[model samples]
Target: MELIVLDTAEAIASRAADAIEALLASKPNAILGTATGSSPLPLYDELTRRYEAGRISFAQVEGFMLDEYVGLPEGHPERYATFMERNLRSRVDMRPGSLHGPDALSEDLQAACDAYEAAMAAAGYCDLQILGIGADGHIGFNEPGGPLDSTTHIDELTEQTRRDNARFFDGDIDAVPTRCITQGLGTIMKARKLVLIATGENKAEAVAHLVEGEIDPRWPATVMQNHPDALVLVDPAAASLLRQRH
Candidate 1:
């Protein structure tokens, strides 16, 4: 695990872009894992810039979304699928159907999760995964007390997660979905590399746990500490609670 403190969110995104650019340079057809939420917005913006500048092309890249909220309509503004399309796929050279996400709308959600997992397995999982640490340290939707070795599955959202995601729903917490289908911790660990972006003072404590704490289920993101190749990028505010600078 490697932790890097940048001056700002933009700087962190730029650095993350460097990594993606290098990976695509080596493997044009790489399977890529993507995350949603405000933490990764700047990184998506940077990627869009690089695409527009002809520095990177996603024509052959395969993208997998980390999670999706249940019960949202297909075009719901806050749906992870809609969010990724509006923020990324449409901004680059990627094909319309190349980016895949779990079927949150399926009546048989458990079956949907199984199919999603099988699809990822067929593709041999991701070469690189982009992530965001929740305020409560959840990754994807793997909430506290969940199994570390879980696969793709449905999960109940913690109240903290729902409150945190309320901003995307126009500050209406009740508008947020209570359940989600997320690639589990075990599934995420299958990626060859993991890159996590975090910022803001609100994320400080979570970042501290992810960087320095043990691999406990309570601080779910702490599982990254065991990944052979994981990079944590944060701004000063997010890194503020760390007792050891190095």
Candidate 2:
């Protein structure tokens, strides 16, 4: 695991965007695994700027979303699908190929999960995965549990998570779905590179736990410790609990 502590949220996002651009430059058609959250908004903004300037193009790039609200409609304003489209897809020039996530109302949920996994497998797997850590240490909605699932599947959102995400629902916690479809930790581990973006004081504890503590599912982000190349990009507030810096 590698750590980068930036002075501010903007700096963190700028540096993360530079790293992603470098990766994309090295592999134009890279399969990028993406997450939707406030932490990654700046990174997406930077990417959009570069694309608009003709310095980068997503024409051949492929991507898979990390998670989605299971009960939300495809066009639901609060859905991950809507988030990505507004924040990313609409800003970039992507090919006709799909950017997949879970089907909220599929007849067979398990089959939908399997198909998502299969689509990723057929895409030659993700080369770089962008992530955001939940305050409770969940990654892609894999909350504290007995064992992390190894495939795409539905997850029951903990109250802590629903509360944290309630802002997206106009402070209406009830509007937040109780469940989500998230990529498994095992699936995330397959990516050649992992970039986790966490900002704000709210995330400090979870960042410290995952980066400094022992490997445990109690803090699912801790599993990133095992990834071949995991990089954490955090603002000073988020890195407040780091015992030591490198």
Candidate 3:
């Protein structure tokens, strides 16, 4: 694992954009694993700018969302698909077959998870995966005690997670879906590269626990420490807990 501390969130986002741009440049059909939420918003914005400027295009690129809220309506404003479509997909031009995600309302929820895993496997696995750290140190909704080798599957959001995500649903904790389908740590580890973006002081403890603490399911992100190619892009506020050599 490599730690990169940027001056601000904007800088971290720009660096992430640069990484994606380089990957796309090397392989137009690169499979990109995407994450939703505030951590990656700036990276998406930067990608939009590049797409508009013709510096980069998604025509041949493939996208796979990292997780989704199960039991939510197809068009639920809080669904990960809706979040991706509105925030990122709407801004780019991509082949119809390039974007894929787990269905929130599939008749067979387990089948949905299996299908998503199959789709990812068919896509040649992700060339690079973007990630966000939950306040409780979870990644892609793989809460504490989740199996490191598990594949895509249903997960029950913890109370801390529900409270953290309540802001998106107008502060209604009850509105937060109790279940989610997330890519497993083992699946994420398969990516050729992994980039985790985090900002703000709110994430400091989680970041520290993940980077400096033991590798345990208690803090899902800590598993990244064992990945061959994983990067943690953080701002000063988010890296405050680190004990710097200098």
Candidate 4:
């Protein structure tokens, strides 16, 4: 794992964008794992800027979202699908219909999960996956106490997660879905490389656990410590809790 503490969130986004640019330079048709939420917004903006400048093209790239909320009707403003489409797919050169998230609305959710896992398996997993750490240390909705090797499946959203995400639902926790279909830790680990962006003091403790604490399920993001190639980018506020610099 490589830890890079930048002076600002924009700096962190640039560094993270550099990784994507390098990957696209070498593999234009690379499979990219995408993440949603405010932490990654700047990175998405940077990518869009590069695309407009002709420095990058996502024409043939395929994108898979990390997770999606269940029970939300399609086109809901807060749905992960809508979020990714509005924030990234529509902003880049990526072909329409190229970005995908789990089928959380399926009546048979278990089957939906199986199909999602099968699809990712067929694509050979992602070449690079973008991530954001939850304040409670969850990754892709894999909350604490979940198995380290879980696959695509339904998971009950933790209360902390719901409360944190309520802001997206206009501060109505009831508007947030209680369940989500997330790519498991094992699914994420299959990526050839991982890039995680975190900012804000709220993320400080989680970043500390991810970078320095022992690999334990209690700090779900700590699983990144086991990835052979993972990059962690953060601003000073997010890195504030790190006990060691290196």
Candidate 5:
């Protein structure tokens, strides 16, 4: 595991983008695992800039989302698919057929989960996965106490997670979905490389726990400690609670 603390969010994005650029250069059709939320917005923006400037191209790349809220209407602006379209796919040249997310509205959700896992296996595991740590130390909706070695499955969102996402639903906590389908810790661990980004004071504790705490299921992000290549990028505010610096 490697920790990189940057003075500003832009620096963090730049460093992370450079890593992605190198990966794409090595393998044009690399599979990318992406996470939603504010933490990765800057990184996406940087990637967009690179694509527009002809420095990079996602035309041959394939992408996968970490999770999707259950029961969100197809066109809901807050749905994870829509979020990705607005923030990434629509802006880049990635093939429409190559990006995938778990079926959030499938009638047979268990089948959907199984199919999602199969789809990922067919595309080959993610070469590089971008992640964002929740304030409660969750990742990909895998909340506290979730199975450390679980696979693709449905998850009940914790009250804290719903509350944290309420802002996206116009501050209506009731509008946030209480359940979601997320790739499990075991699924995420299969990625060849992992890059986690965190910013702001709100994430300080979680960042600390991920970087310095014991490897326990209570803090899902801590499982990255067992990964062969994991990189954590954080702004000063997010790194405040860490006992040491890079």
Candidate 6:
């Protein structure tokens, strides 16, 4: 694992975009794994700018969302698919039918999870995966105490995670989905490369745990420590708890 501390979130995003640009330049058909939420929005914004400037193109790229909320309506604003449409797919020249995500609304969630995993396998798995650490140290929807070697599956959202996401639902915790389908730690580890970004003081503890704590499933992100090509990028606020400076 490598730690990179930037002065601001924008800088962190720019660096991440540069990496993606380079990857796509060499491999236009690269499979990209993406995470939703504020941490990766800036990276998406930067990519969108590059695409508009003709410096980059996702025309041949394929994408997979790391997770999706269960029980949300198809067009609900808070749905992960809607989030991707608004923040990424619609902004770039990505190929149609190339972006895939778990079926969050399926009545048979187990089947949905199985199908998602099958699709990913058929697509050759992700070449690069972008991630964001939750305040409670979860990655994707793999909350605390989740199995470290788990695969794509349904997960019940923890209270802290639901509360953290309440802001997206107008601060109504009741509006947030209590469950989600997420790629598991074992699945994420299969990616050739992993990039995790975190910003703000609120994420300091999680960042510290991911970077400095024991490799324990209780703090799911700690599993990244064993990934052969993991890169952790954080703004100063989020890196505040780190004893070592990059």
lDDT of 3 at 62: 87
Stretch of 10 with least lDDT, candidate 5? 95-104
- Candidate with more favorable, higher lDDT: 3 or 4: 4
Query: Candidate 5: what lDDT?
Result: 0.94
Estimate the TM-score for candidate 6.
Answer: 0.98
How many backbone clashes does every candidate have?
Answer: 0, 0, 0, 0, 0, 0
- Candidate 1 per-residue lDDT over residues 1-246, each given as its tens digit: 999999988999999999999999999999999999998899999999999999999999999999999999999988999999999999999998999999999999999999999999999999999999899999999999998989999999989999999988889999999999999999999999999999999999999999988889999999888899999999999999999986
Model 6: ten consecutive residues of lowest lDDT: 90-99
Better of 2 and 3 by lDDT: 3
Clashes of 6: 0
TM per candidate: 0.99, 0.97, 0.97, 0.99, 0.99, 0.98
Off by over 4 Å in 6: none
lDDT of 6: 0.93
lDDT over C-alpha atoms for residue 127 of model 4:
99
For each candidate, the alpha-carbon lDDT, in order, equals 0.95, 0.87, 0.90, 0.94, 0.94, 0.93
Candidate 2 local Cα displacement, residue 78, angstroms: 0.9
Local accuracy of candidate 6 as per-residue lDDT tens digits, 160-234: 999999999999999999999999998999898999999999999999989999999889999998899998999
lDDT by residue (125-199, candidate 5, tens digit) is: 899999999999999999999899989999999999999999999999999999999999999999999999999
Taking the tens digit of each residue's C-alpha lDDT, what string does model 3 give over 91-163? Answer: 8997664678887688898999999999999888899999999988999999998888888998999999999
Candidate 6 Cα deviation (angstroms), residue 62: 0.9
Clashing residue pairs in candidate 2 (N, C-alpha, C atoms within 3 angstroms): none
Could you give me the TM-score of model 5 versus the true structure? 0.99
Candidate 3 displacement at residue 35 in angstroms: 0.4
Query: What stretches of model 3 exceed 4 Å from their correct place?
Result: none
